[model samples]
Target: MSVSDTIVRWRYRAVPDHLLGEILTKNWIDNAIPLLFLAAVVVAFGSVIPDFYSASNVAILLRQWGEFSLLVLGLTIVMVAGGIDLSVGSTFALGNIVALALLNVAGWPLPAVIVATLAAGAAVGLVNGLLVGYLRLRAFLTTLVTLIIVRAVVDMLLLKYSVKIAGAFVDSDAWYFLGEGSILGIPFSVVVAIVVAVTLHLVLSRTRLGWHVLAVGGSRRSAHNVGIPVRRVICATYVVSGTLAALAGLLFASRLGGAGADTGLGLEIAALTAAVVGGNSLGGGRGSAAKAIIGSVTVLLMVNSLVRLGVPSGANSLLLGLVLLAAVAIDVRWLKNRHKVLSKVYVSPTYAALPAAPPTDGDSPYAVNDRLRSVELIGLGDIDGPEDVILDADDNLYAGNRTGDIVRFLAPDYTEHEVYAHVGGRPLGMAIARDGSLLCCIGGMGLYRVAQDRSIEKLTDETNRSWFSVVDDSRLKLADDLDITADGRIFFSEATVRYEMHEWPVDCLESRGNGRIICFDPAAGTTRTVLRNLVFPNGICMAHDGQSFMFAETWACRVSRYYYDGPKKGTVEPVIPDLPGYPDNINRASDGTYWLAIVGMRTPSLDLALGMPGFRKRMARRIAPDEWLYANINTGCIVRFDESGRIIETLWDLGGENHPMITSMREHKGYLYIGGITNNRIGRLKLNDADPSWTGPKSYWGRT
Candidate 1:
């Protein structure tokens, strides 16, 4: 009776018989750029190399990349979580040596040896994670130390003996099978690596675990505020890194038929290079295992080809270094931030069912750069919310602040300081006065000025000549950045009229482009719109060549050059196309090199939202008061370009501790000064011993 009743009851449940269907429906592959690139690289290699397409050679290649692939996959997780383990290569070598020693010298069982080796790797990673995640160490510095010490330890141990361990636990047959044999014509090692890659890829792209990692990496502080256990997650990432390295060590030991010193030599650099090259941002957040795998294979193939062509390892390293530098320089950091305009693909009519005016080109600007190259922290002593700053004719520095003071840095060393004037408002953008005073764009109270003796005077409260908003609502305008022109006019950007400083995203998603480039004239004591209906117009810079100037449209992800004195006084041209991130304050380079500060970047989701105004507004409106969808601004940094829009270099401030939230990057004389709208102090740094090529603290680009 019991057996029949049990069978009858179980027949209906059967673990929900439609599990496969659910999996098929929910599987991730909608935007598999990494896999596509990976397949493309393999195919390209096959076409070029004679044996690459052959099954046997392909199997071998898979095995080769497979060993490194584990490390790459592990790195993907950590990178997604916004951390890295440069000590992995050392720990990898450690695993190999330890495993070999365990099996051969200590005569341990294979299972116990494998476990011990993995434990050693985990321990190494733990040290890195504890210092970086828990103890608040810089990921780069902490792992950098481990990279040196771990490599030194390995080198000392290996060079001291030229040691070799011949494992006697697993017979030669098993080793051969692992290294060279295949089941169903597929190398077991490659298969193992594939399974791992697929599993991790799914985890990152589909599961909550991947989402959590990305959330944490994208904004650690935000994630922590949301109770994401950021430190634990970051530390766990390193532990995963260690596990993968140990596994890779197992595979490496087999491949060589024994363990040696070079088992994982220089692997840390390779892993880092692969992660970054594959587009795992060095700035943290915005990465995937699939992408990392593709990147790893691509790097591996590139090296293989170079080696085939008689390039020394040193030369290859040099080439790799250049590639890594160039890739980061391109601001892949911003690829995750751009919203693509819909020209009729991927956007459905349901998402576009707005009963409103149809959009024309530039009718609206985007909600949020091409990319942030790097941030050079220029110290300005202490000032609360040092929002915006500029230089004067004497090379003396002046920065406005929420401290309600126009603070002046009187000397080169920044030691001589003074609270020049108290404006009694949240001062934002500021400029040098024609009367040798300070003109500041104070927040909430419009633009104001300070006298030589520190008297504050209000310039103008509102504009009357031109409407800068999409709906002609004057209250929507908020005075932001300002620049003084040669004709005694002040051209300023109202960041958003609708949303003050706090509700910026709503202004962004509304996509109304409700900002403007307004010109204020001292002679007339009036203001007019030079250009209206611009999105998040930020960073005003007059061209040093005397023809025109440029301004960064932050939400739109491009910098536009506007001519002032030419026949094409209203024409704007793109200085950089497809910025990876959102641009912020841009200032003219003293040496003709323009520095554009990218606040955030373009993301696929944001791109899709661009085509669907309703979707964007819906998301924007539905966002919880405490929740926000910020671009990966904190990751990576600002970019520098020549006069002709050529990329010169990048300034990266990964992990954003001292120089976090770099909204404005100003280069003065020999030092580059950085100001974040959110921070209290101005950060400073020396630029590779200072570029003597640049000059500054002048009348700003052709102004008399």
Candidate 2:
């Protein structure tokens, strides 16, 4: 075997058939594991340790977890924004000392002391933010220095004062209640912590600031390019962290009735551990406030249990260190293998082995022809991936390019091209509307319309999600092709709702129903699903009767017909039962037939692999993309079909020298225009018998 063959064999293997449930719930498991472990620890310790779950001990647990919870919440925000603040522990210590000094030494009012303490924390955080965000300093180093400096200064102040506040009664009752008082059998501190956690959870999950933070963390460069306030978002996260840490310190000092130098000594590490153990990614953009709470509870439970079991203080530290290391390692591995785990759960459809290619003799229907051999290449080096091409009444050729642009080649020599519009996504099948607007289906984005002034407008990017989908499926995942009806209704196909546009091949590997057909009615201003649970629905074209439309399910290797008007309205039937290759865009031909572009041919190896879902799953998880058994798209052919689903003729580019992977084909004025997703140029094939003056818009709407 060749080196490539050996590599392919090693990558392909069988996966367990019964692991679908595990794959679907992997994310929930990641979040719930820490909570479950904490529960187990509680049960184990409570059974042996005396009064471990007693009322008094439970209250103590709540108070301790509450204090740590505050710090963890702050750390979560900073971490989610892709930054780290090592000075939170120091800030907590400093805030406590400042509060005590203001209340006891300066003789300030309790409220003023509390505000000033929190302000001090915010100020420290501002400095860290300025250094990291504005000055572009490394977050770790900058916060580390701040931690040392703040800790030393706070410790010096505490040593110098060595004073305690002496008031127990009416004067400080309100202040005392904040930290030590109880409400409805729960500690006041615990109540406060719950409130803060709930509020921050809502803020992080529902607000624009939360999105900005996640975006910046996911990719700073991308966030900047999209005009997000990356630096400001990062800076604000640090400020929130400092403020919360200070509040935690105030609660600690109030509950203990005194401030100590080592009050928050190891709090930074503890908070970090809680965040990570709760499934928050340290690398950023993938954590939540709720996770922080669960993590904090888990960490506190372990420490409390150890202390109750007579474990030495040093041993407690060692245990925590080990736990932190384990948690980080688990988090990193989970993040790295998440996609693989998901792939394991996908169940692919079984496909029969593809028969040998039909004889290419001159008398055979599948005879090889050189129709595309002498094709002229347009936009040779300028355009990339013109997946679909169309023409207007003036015979101006238009094609969607890979760079999110729709380029138009003016008539008369058809050489000069100009960028018609930038759709901000890969534009696919296009249709000319009655009002002269261009309707385009963008890959990642949804169906859009390009106006006469070259302005792009989103018609609709969402449809009714399937009832079984737990995910928010309102947004279109991959809008592949679209066709406009005479009555202003638009029919489109979402290739696969499960995967993004770039992961199109992954959808084929799964071979499960992840696609659907949708109809957008401009008159009603609504978009609704016409058919559901389709397997890779692709090209769409209106029928000659204008009462129905034909759409292709690429992975299923068939074209289906759906009638919107007439006797078969609200029903769908197969147009073409099978094809030799994966069909892409289907356009109406001048002779009232349809032209279907086969993007890829079926290979024996790929056909056999499809029959074994286990092998496909294993390949998805283990093999690199370049080595995967992708559909054979290097060779292609365009076939014409009549209304009865009978093949009229086949045009092949056997060598693919000029036109490879034909995704779309449009017949205009005696010429067939072809486009491909990976090709760098547009192809033109002249036809001797077709009308020389007919254009797409003229055929559909007649001359204005």
Candidate 3:
């Protein structure tokens, strides 16, 4: 190899640059900036103030964090449900006054005081929920009104009972413990805060209510269309916010043992800043409990650090306003542009240099001929994009189309056809199981079965994830083909994990080893990857010996055999090391040979680009997707080969008028049935010297 070729190969193929792009595409990446900022602030504060990390000061900080975190968590839930609660601060103050009045002026029991304080907060929340959710009032204006009303109520109560509350004192040990006691070296309030945080996290992540909140926040019209109780979810979120804010106020009253006009003042603004800075979206539907806690801690630390630095109160407010402004700007821009950035970097091209294609021009074994030119067309114009064809025991032909329907034609005459099943995903390769059920590979979905009753069931959509992979490889992204073994194990191929079905062209451009072979055992109910890092593994056919199967790597233009059972198990060996065109689905022939479909032919221009990864990468980045160079899939032909990998003959539609770009072919009842991914019909060519009684099902399962 030349020096340039070696360097290109090592840089593009060996180095895992694509993983960086994959990491950027993950949702967790949104929290990275906030976490980093939090770390930087803590370091800065600790350096400036020696006492910031002292044990006594740290305990004081934790006590403050406990109450502040609850307020932020409540707001986070409300925002996630596509609403806001500006009344949280006012409700907190109201709860404090109500708790003090019940304890000192009314002389109620401690439990009654707690209950009354909570009810006051809930009542405020109910008004907001009813106005915004049921009456269709704007959330911002409704909550603002409630904030004013609740604050006014708190001021009135404080004016009426300020003297009596200051003099009265509770002497009970339980009351003192609730206020300033420690549990296991942690503050009593902090322990309660941690428990509440964990419970809310579970509810948000693992419950149906959380899913409903996200759905409603994402799109209320869509949520309602899907039968979600949108208004009720919104109302419930406000109620949750109110209850949590009240709880925080109760904790504060316990710790402080007093109330004033400025109690809970500007608390709402601080909570909003913390939630937004922590990485929770103000636009809603995309946040978590962790985000709320992180934001709260970061903001709380900064505020305390400013006070310790002796910064003027007005200047502190100015600095906080600036920080909130910066956080909001970053959040809005990141939310708007993340997907755009992902699209630009996600399609990472890599080096791919296939061996020189076999000779097909002259008297070589792979020489093309027009043997398929005069083949009869079946269901012509009545079907579209029949990627693969199969037949049942009665010789009834079934073909999957681009519209996600499996169409079936009656036997013998081949005139009448009907939609066999509506699978709802583009179905590719198919096989008839011994139990008379039809197993199919759906493009975006995984392996599925169409039973004798025509009911559809998913076999498996995931496998064990690869340990070294940056992207999650467990979910089946593009299941391509399959063939069953003698022991009821189904061996299949996944064309590419990084791209979806419509993105196959992008996979072709990359030409990387993004494919794998998988095995699904019926008895054990397990699916696993048996082979990894193959180049667009497409076609799968159980070898005649039953111990192995032949799979085609499309981009590499070759076929290989994988031993799944017996002595040679877990081994892979090349069957057809080179081909003139891109190989797709492979099927057993009636004469014990195999039929391979050349989905696309190779060209010198494309071959040159594969060796130059730099050129493809530039093209992908600079050129519009529709204008970029694409593989020539408009013209394809079928090749017949024996078990020894010797090409016996090649067939083509030289006129390109029928069966253009063949993707699959099946032999049944003396005829070879052809299907194409881009063609509008099925082609049937009479095999001159084939077994007339042979059918695919009969060959695999034997006579019933």
Which one is best on lDDT? 3
Question: Which candidate number has the best TM-score?
Answer: 3
Candidate lDDT (C-alpha), each: 0.68, 0.83, 0.89
TM-score to native of every candidate shown: 0.45, 0.83, 0.97
- Write one digit per residue (lDDT tens) for candidate 3, span 588-631: 99888999999988998888888987788789888998988788
Count of clashing residue pairs in every prediction: 39, 0, 0
The alpha-carbon root-mean-square deviation between model 2 and the true structure, to one decimal in Å, is 5.5
Candidate 2, which ten residues in sequence have the lowest lDDT sum?
Answer: 347-356
State model 3's lDDT.
Answer: 0.89
Q: Local error of candidate 2 at 228, Å?
A: 8.4
